[model samples]
Target: MLARSIIFLLLSLSACPLFAQQKYIMTVRGKVKADAIGRTLAHEHIVTNFIGAATVVDVPGDDSVVIAKILPQLLRLKGQGINTLIECTPNFIGRNPALLKKLSELSDLNIVTNTGLYSAVDKKYLPPYAFTENAAGIASRWEAEWTNGIGGTGIRPGFIKLGAGSSALDSIEAKMLAAAILLSRKSLLPIAIHSGSGQAAISAFEQLKKSNWKPEKLIWVHAQNGTDEERAMLANEGVWISLDGVSEKSWEQYAGMILFLKKRNMLHRLLISHDDGWAVLENGSYNKLDLFENGNSIPYSTLFTKLLPALKKAGVTESEIDMILRNNTGDCFSF
Candidate 1:
């Protein structure tokens, strides 16, 4: 009788799911596959710091205070038919388990958070934990968030994120990338990279591939900022390209990039996002806008309300748009 009881307990423990607290049999292991049929914004920041970047802006306040002020703005986004938000802030300003759970409870939108490092440009501002921490150290932190919970909630991050700036890649970045790649392979998680400039995407990809990462599980964001050759090479490598920076007046660079890629019939592997999250005050109040607007506020609806149609009118097929905006994102970020 004792032996039988022990065996039953062991079996029950083994059968318990990884993210058992989330009420799902399987943890979100790889690209999430879903209908994603409604109006979905591929990339948008529900909450991030305007001053978190290395460069300081006029916005004066504590980081926590700034983040606190941004909650209502995200709520506004939910009302705009934006069903999803991929909050790609790096670990220092990201992986807020309590904040994410709060947002999830507040809105019907799906808020998929990330865990990883930022570009070399942010090296100056990175917390001591990430810099002093080794690859295993970082991985352990990430695993804690995944298995246990983030910021005291059982809400684990839905994906991983990496960033590259104008400067060349560094050892720290490489180490973070390697760690994220290894964790991704072990856990079958999807990764999102910020290729703002330089050969960061290619460099990160080289590292991930070296670690035998599945190309399908990789998402190289800000591809709209890369050159045509770079974009084509990445597409041919079977990585998903995110063109979420499209803006008519502001992001002409990305606009041209997307149009060119579409012309080359390389739009299927693409995922569209606006990457917007800025608070701009209008008459006696404020509003939120795109990330790259340079203080010029463009409503968050510009993507679905404007840029997507422009892509269609510019000879980009409806099928391609649908795949990028809805299909590819859901598929790549699913486990």
Candidate 2:
């Protein structure tokens, strides 16, 4: 009787959601429990290169200079209570997993990276193979990155990052979205698309439905680009709406959007961040880093310093703010 009781207790505990069904969020260092990431910035970048994918190459000695420039910014962000930052720079646009890993360790911040190709900006960031490869073939490449780790760095991506133009998904963007759906289905990772407009977001969401993908797993990044009606429509359809471009100049705009969603009771579907980062520049024979001209003079600090206070002043309760910054972010990226 004693032995049977002990066995049953052990089995019950093993079958509990906290054990058998544990959810995790992958970061550059490794996997962590979903709830462990606190006060996450869902969309941000570390460094980016706009030199076009055709001729862009990672300079061998640029890592040190990058660290020197960006690490202090991250440390300051850490000081402001940001526990995790989802680095949005895709592969060709300076997605440096190894550098992100080192920064994560040094800053003691959980940094998440992504797997996917960028198809916006007239497909300038896309590699030649992206055009040649079929949807399945492109998905296979992203899957391999997810499975084997990106660039053999032993660091896996936590989500899929993609981009599309303002009008609609062009053929290549459509193919990229199809591949993202395939990979998301296989890996259960969320897809964050840099949508340029409401129409573009609608186009992608429609495609996702046709593929039978879960709407909750699709994050419409830059949802601020869409109207309140469009945001509400997509949020009602269970898509995660990311208003990531919060800056000092745009806090009122963001506050209005947040209040709009809050009035509609769609705050649970919302995520916010300052889409801030540094851009790599070519100067003479050496590479230089420049702050992105996004109007946030400080990278990663506007949300806490400017937006949060404004949201609070506008009657957003602490719990609701927490939901947007912590809960929604964790749920959107966790698998």
Task: Please name the candidate that would achieve the greatest lDDT relative to the true structure.
Answer: 2
lDDT of each: 0.64, 0.91
Off by over 4 Å in 2: 1-20, 283-287
Per residue, candidate 2 scores C-alpha lDDT tens digits across 77-163 of: 888888999999998887889889999999999999999999999899999999898999999999999999998888999999999
RMSD of 1: 7.5
Q: Write down the lDDT that model 1 would get.
A: 0.64
lDDT score, candidate 2, position 305: 80
Question: Candidate 1's residue-wise lDDT over 4-103, tens digit each?
Answer: 9999988887778752332111111222335543445666664444444344333222334434566666667777656567766555542344555555
Q: List the lowest-lDDT window of 10 residues for candidate 1.
A: 22-31
TM-score of 1: 0.75
Model 2: residue 61 alpha-carbon error in angstroms: 3.5
